[model samples]
Target chain A: MIDIYEIIGLIAATLTTSAFVPQVYKAWKSKNTESLSLTMYLAFFVGIMLWLVYGIHLNSLAMILSNTATGFLALILIILKLKYK
Target chain B: MIDIYEIIGLIAATLTTSAFVPQVYKAWKSKNTESLSLTMYLAFFVGIMLWLVYGIHLNSLAMILSNTATGFLALILIILKLKYK
Candidate 1:
């Protein structure tokens, strides 16, 4: 039986994970990452990486999915910031 | 006994939670959120809220603390975005 709460977790994961799309799109289109803070994203990436580790420890699907997805997005932004500036 | 992994999670939470400070400071200092995506933060806020709920359900201290802390920062950014633009 699928837990409704887990279902909610998945939905939440989807929402948060997809939230990076617009930023990535805009950054890709504009070729500008001046406004995006590199420090924030780097810290975020590290944090997400840790979260992934912790999630794996707990065997949480939601944490795993959300962090993995967003970690990639943050990497993109981080790379963009590096390439652009 | 405090689990070492849980300690890692707390440190990770602190890293991620503190990541927002520079952003809020930057936005507030410049009064420019043109670079910050409102949709991204809005989606993130909602997602974090859900995570908080899920964390509460599972009684996960790290998840609860991290989301609650970051959620406040995200809200600050959201409000700043609205105020600036």
Candidate 2:
């Protein structure tokens, strides 16, 4: 059974994972990636990919799902950063 | 003994945690957060804080350390975003 900590983790994951949506929307809509750091997005993308791998190794559905979504969002921001730059 | 997946997870945690540094530096240096989404940072800050709590509850050193550092960094960015706005 899922406990309180797991529930907190799930909520944390949801918030952090979904947090990128507004960023993507803001950047895509504004067509502005000026304040965004290219290095951050690049590293974040790679990191999320690694976390996805780690999740797979651990057989964790939560990590896999969250990292996949976060990675995709970070990739979009990276592309947007480069394209909009 | 630590295994390969744990190593990968460590590296992933390091990368994602450190990734915020460049962003905080960029925003502080540029003093331009026009493109940075306030909602994103706000949600991310809260999310990371929650993750830190979850980590502590789980007694995971890795999650605790990484989330603590990442939370601090995210908080700085949030402050910078608001300050430089």
Best by DockQ: 1
Candidate 2 lDDT by residue in tens digits, A1-85: 8777667877888989988798788889999999788988888889899888976775655567788999989999999999989
TM for every model, in the order presented, reads 0.89, 0.81
Candidate 1 — what's its lDDT?
0.87
User: Chain B TM-score for each model?
Assistant: 0.92, 0.85
State the DockQ of every prediction.
0.70, 0.69
How many residue-pair clashes does candidate 1 contain? 0
Whole-model lDDT values for every prediction? 0.87, 0.82
DockQ of 1: 0.70
**Candidate 2 residue pairs in clash (backbone atoms < 3 Å):** none
Runs of candidate 2 with Cα error greater than 4 angstroms are A32-35, A81-85, B82-85
Instruction: Please give the clash total of every predicted structure, in order.
Output: 0, 0
